[model samples]
Target: LNFQLLRVMEEWQQQLGEQHYVAMANDLLMNLDLPGQVSSLTDIGPELLVQLFEAICCDCRVGMIRPAVTQADLRHNLACVIDSLANDVLHVSLSHIRPADLMSGNYEAIRNLLEIFHGLMEFLVGRSAGGDGGDVTAETQLEENENLNGRLTDQLDRIAGQAAEINELAKRLAELRQADRPLPQTPLPATAAAAAVDAEAAPNGDTSDEGIVQ
Candidate 1:
């Protein structure tokens, strides 16, 4: 079953999770880029959010150089480490804001965010090309990731507000029904369940229906 592969996947997913949550937190932080202290994780801006999401999805390759880990495992682990460091960037951004004047893509904020990802990936390419680790700089060039369409918190807020309002309306409906109803004298079949629940029910009730609304 390639348990190691599975573990590697699990680790990668966790790295994604950490990066996912943390980067969103950064976007929510000192939104305007503070000077030296970490901005709130929630203050990270739109552009940073997109870049972080791209870093999460992008595949990173790291070479096997007599390490205890295999190429795939090492790649997965290194990808995870890169993600972890990206979160570290967000963590640092909470308190430290790189100045636009000094921000030339070589600073620690940039390093903390991107260096390891490109460096290790390139290191893999070099080893493949010539069988040795190549010189990789502590600086990396970050291309802005274009896929993260909207801020995570904004999405969450919209979903949550819709859910709350919908659920509240459902509650009001249920109260109205109760006031008008006589308890069914005969226990109805499971088929008689309230509309929403029945439509969404599995034996375990794990349905993707409007329950999120109700």
Candidate 2:
């Protein structure tokens, strides 16, 4: 998938020039499409979504995006991805009757969802730290700018907070799964007495250890 993205990027840079190519990339990142395909992260499934995000981040970092893709676009796309994932997490979390069941339910899919958000956040923070738009001026007046920025900030903050809430719930559920799971009687990597100990420990005959075991 990344190889294909690279090839497309090369072709785009050659034909459309760096500026337009950057704009195109921004559209893909924002709208989650690639040329003729509807290749959004949600559309790609869990396995490929992370790879696609990695490719997008790489493009943002060193793909020579200039004169078209602005820092604002980068930030906007990151925010969009974050917001989208947050909504997904909230939906799944809210819809489920038992949050702990998430481990046996849609756990893998939910984890993948969070992973994408984390990846985007890492890229966004890294790009922001590079002073990508440091020279860009905020020409708005203080009062009006503060009002507008405050509203935008509030929206992003709400999304981020929702994502964080989902993340915390996921973590708690995962830990619940782990804690409820029976511990191995024999530890892995046997010591000098390896010949005597069985690597596969017997499952606990005690059922109480399993809490809401699915």
Candidate 3:
């Protein structure tokens, strides 16, 4: 299966140009964290097979390959890859793969599935290179651009929402600070008892002792 996958990739390199092939390969290996030099797909371990398939599925989903590739097609191809890896390479049971009952162990089935995958790859690469009577039409390119624009618009909307939330939080914080400020202190009026004492001491508008008995 690895050999087959490698052959498909090499064909892609030849047909799609080294730059395009390298870009696809790098995308697959982006976060795999594989050790040493991985000069080919065969260098990838059985455990990482799912990741490789997932990357390819993503490419298909995003219209990176051919617009004709549908979700069902991706699903089928993915099942094929998983089936081949689980049964042949890893020698594991189908339960290990999601939708365990997807495919049963059979040499014939495996071969057929691999051939299908190869054909699918060929179709993808051929379409990308404007061959196989399936050149990327203007409509497909427009659809891809619209999809990309939609993603960018969603991101921008999310960013704008976050920015608005931050601004609102900042405004609330400033209002809280204003509300927490200490108010200026005001002098209190004199007590009633103190006022009475002053009035008594100044009786008849005089503070002198002229009316006091000797």
Candidate 4:
């Protein structure tokens, strides 16, 4: 499913080129679901949400390139998408599943969010390194860099925090599942339970079904 989206993005990049693709992506981001429900996504299933996240990441990366989008616009969209996935999706959906039934795909959503943000951060770093700060005064460039850095740091923190939360939740779930599990069955009492208990407890206890000593 992820492969298909990547292929589509690659084909689009080939057909539209980076600049136009980025523009289209920015527009798409503006319209895509922002306050989407993680619960709702689960109802339909994770595959759709996974694809949506991947598509957003791919487009946002293209849009962040030179001559496509302003840093402000890119950052705003990134924030919205990340917030939606984190608050509306990962955190919310984690509450719904049983620990014994933890799905790998749920964690995949977190990975997808991290992947997108990391890619964007890398693009930002590359852009900064390559003098995308040009045409601005030194003070302005410094402030812009600071703002971008802050946004990236806040997002990385959010993603990292979410990852930790998921880990803890998984552990807790395992504990709960283990605790809730039924104990191994014991042999049933023969005749009266009190007599069975006495027979089992005697010094020469031999309550075998084949030879129950009186």
Leading candidate by TM-score: 4
Decreasing TM-score order of the candidates: 4, 2, 3, 1
Clashing pairs in 3: none
TM-score of each: 0.20, 0.26, 0.25, 0.31
Model 3 misplacement above 4 A: 1-134, 182-214
**Tens digits of per-residue lDDT for model 1, 21-88:** 45434432333232333333334332443244334434433232233344344334434444443353
Residue-level lDDT tens digits of model 2 in 57-95: 444332322232554544344333344333532222222
Q: How big is the positional error of residue 115 in model 4, measured in Å on the Cα after superposition? A: 9.7
Error (Å) of candidate 3 at residue 53 is: 25
Q: What is the C-alpha local distance difference test score of candidate 2?
A: 0.39
lDDT-best of 1 and 3:
3
2 against 3, candidate with superior lDDT: 3
**Positional deviation of 180 in candidate 1, in angstroms?**
2.1
Off by over 4 Å in 1: 1-150, 181-214
Best by lDDT: 4
